[model samples]
Target: MAETRIRIGIHQEVRHPYITHNLVGVTFSSLQVIHSPPTKMAETRIRIGILGCANIARKVSRAMLLSPNTTISAIGSRSLEKAIAFASENHFPESTKKYGSYEAVLDDPDVDAVYVPLPTSLHLRWAVLAAEKKKHVLLEKPVALDVGELDRILEACESSGVQFMDATMWMHHPRTAKMKEVLSDPHRFGQLKSVHSTFSYVGEGDFLQNDIRVNPSLDSLGVLGDAGWYSIRAILWAYDYELPKTVTAIGDPEYNESGVILSCGASLNWKENGKVATFYCSFYTNLTMDITVLGTKGSLRVHDFVIPFNENVGPFYAVANSRWKELSLGCEPEPSEFKITTVLPQEALMVQEFGRLVQGINGGEAKPEKKWPTISRKTQAVIDAVVASIKNGFKPVEVVY
Candidate 1:
């Protein structure tokens, strides 16, 4: 058979002798052959607009830059000076636009999506507005003060036909996927029996009294919304987003003068499966983030589930079918550490994935994905239950959703 060659993008055409007559219509190159259109055609990269100059936005901005399919198109804040400073400090591209107000970024025709890193109280307003403007929204975690607020944001996104995702960076980490696989295996993990999660960080001096998280108006739920959000989401993820039957707030929650929670813990019970989970979140403890899942046949433990100690790789421990030694001094099968490495950090992967979805919509090949919003809703629902439990004198509150 005569060698066949096909050109894609600006790459030079190369002969593929191994490509058969049946593959003539397919695109081929010296290295490999792909049954698709030419690559030279310009593909749309999702242009992301940052809604605020919050501390978290700095990390996310770097992620957007690292993502191959996304770009930091613009950034806006109430103060133009702050926006300019944030952009400059984050090393935003020279071509990146800056605005005095978030609305301006939303109105920009070039911005295809918006990353809302605003305070929890402002999410409902800005997130909905971004959706109404036909821009995809990547909202920060603790998506809202309550499930109702989250529902409102979701409704707007659904009505406007745009994608919605919470900024749960760890969810996009390769280690998380691998951990899920292990937990789902029947022989390896059996049925999940219980789970315990904790996330906390000590807030010193001004942070304890003046940080937005402790400020009632800015973040009413306080540490529950900031730190507990991760713990609750981790538990929910382990249960595959299944709502528990009841949530009971653990003994006396510590609160600041403004009645904002500074520390709290909760227990979730799933009556149907007899599964139980507990989580503790605080802003007054040593920095720690842990998740331990126990199953009938195995167990898994992760010390840094929220932010990895190292960006290049995340480590987790897992053990199965253990037996005690003769003196009960140790176990027969010891836990082994597994490290999942990535070229880009989890946050960058998150931006890349969100951008990929937006690109699909831009190409008219697919609609916005619903999995993200669904998970976000479930997390918010659990949070609502926990809050209700605390409000009702630490009584158990049934999870309606």
Candidate 2:
């Protein structure tokens, strides 16, 4: 059977109906098409180009190759030699094109999408440009420096009719969904009361001095945007993506001489019913990513909410409606430990999910899923509120949205 390629914009060239082959470089079971036409068996893959050779790009590049319907068709860097080295060091296919400039990747008709792991400061410029070029975008978070900047990127994607997603790995983990199921159970968890989250890891001396995250001009939001984003997003996810009524800085944020945040904590309150959440993100501590949530009848706890200790399996604890024992020495039932397993890493899952959406858009079977970007905006809005609170002498700042 001759391959029929349908080009959507200058990016996508999708095969109709059946999906054969792994689509990824690996040989695996064929993926069944979600919208199979009454035609023949055919496989579809999304050809992704990568912008920049940032360190995080290495992991995402691997993920793109692992995703069943995604491939790294090209990669670009300011230096042609650097791009060539990065592609080789990351083990990209020999056929993968290496360009000296990001624009070349965007201009490549074979590239259906682009994963941008550039510094946070550069997100707005490149993301908007990628969208305008009709390439689906997988951007690194915090998606923008502020909500206003983020809106521009979103608008560009909307105008060009392309998919947009921020890279937040934990959100795609199976363990996240499992934990949510328990948290959402009315009888088990009841109404949410409070949540506390933290994401912290001590950076090496050199890292603190030289990392982009600690650089004011490159990453002004610093730890708040880097490590804090995960904790904040986790809090928002627990609240069903609802914005807090007010966001207040709990203490003075630690900052370097450059005025970039190094450590910070914030409290989010839904003042009406007195629900509250607190989170801390730091670059001066041991590795930790924790989320603890309490409700009227139950609670949830995850030790590694950002990155599981084990890559293959993740465990979370949940206790629903536990009653005190006669002596009050021990609870009636211990919190049930649920361990979710995954064959692939969470980052791979994220890439796979993004590829699926791109595929649907390519086939005209579906529109871009708004949920991802919506939550991203909410997360950024909350961050903005936190910054405002920090600037206003740690006073509570009302969250507009």
Model 1 TM-score is: 0.90
* Candidate 2 accuracy as lDDT: 0.85
Report the C-alpha lDDT of model 2 over 263-382, residue by residue, as the tens digit: 999999998677999999999988999999999978889999888898777788777667889889887566666667676788988997888788878877789999998999999999
> Model 2: which ten-residue window has the lowest total lDDT?
15-24
Candidate lDDT (C-alpha), each: 0.86, 0.85
Clashing pairs in 2: 18-42
lDDT per residue for candidate 1 within 2-32, as digits (tens), equals 1112223333322222222111122322222
| Residue 7, candidate 2: C-alpha displacement in angstroms | 19
Off by over 4 Å in 2: 1-42
Q: Which runs in model 1 stand beyond 4 Å of their true positions? A: 1-42
